[model samples]
Target: MNGNIRKNIRIGATVDVVLKKDQPTGRLTRGQVARILTGSATHPHGIKVQLQSGQVGRVKVIVEEAPSE
Candidate 1:
């Protein structure tokens, strides 16, 4: 699903995001979410998050939800 909504994303979820430098090219980086950075419930651009790989960006696509423990 799309990644504009904060509720749709979760910590540890795998997702595709656009880094600030890659926004112009619309490049997407795939990684597991480490932490959510967006405070609001929604964002026009998408919720900001930090990836497990230490990459910070706005989510563009929700690839896979982290398995519930």
Candidate 2:
């Protein structure tokens, strides 16, 4: 699923995102979500989040959902 909607994303979910610097190229970085930065329910550009690797960006794709407990 797309990552534009905040509800679709979860902490620990793997996703592809476009960093601020990479927006021009639409480059996507894959990582697990560490924290969600966007407070709104949705964003046209995508939800902002911090990755486990310390990278911050707008989510472009939902790679894998967080495992259920």
Q: Rate the local accuracy (lDDT) of all candidates.
A: 0.96, 0.97
Model 2 per-residue lDDT tens digits across residues 1-69: 989999999999999999999999999999999999999999999999999999999999999999998
How do the residues 1-69 of candidate 1 rate in per-residue lDDT, one tens digit apiece? Answer: 889999999999999999999999999999999999999999999999999999999999999998899
lDDT of 2 at 9: 99
lDDT of 2: 0.97
> Any idea what lDDT model 1 has?
0.96
TM-score of each: 0.97, 0.98
- Which candidate comes out best when scored by lDDT? 2
User: Which ten residues in a row are the worst by lDDT in model 1?
Assistant: 1-10
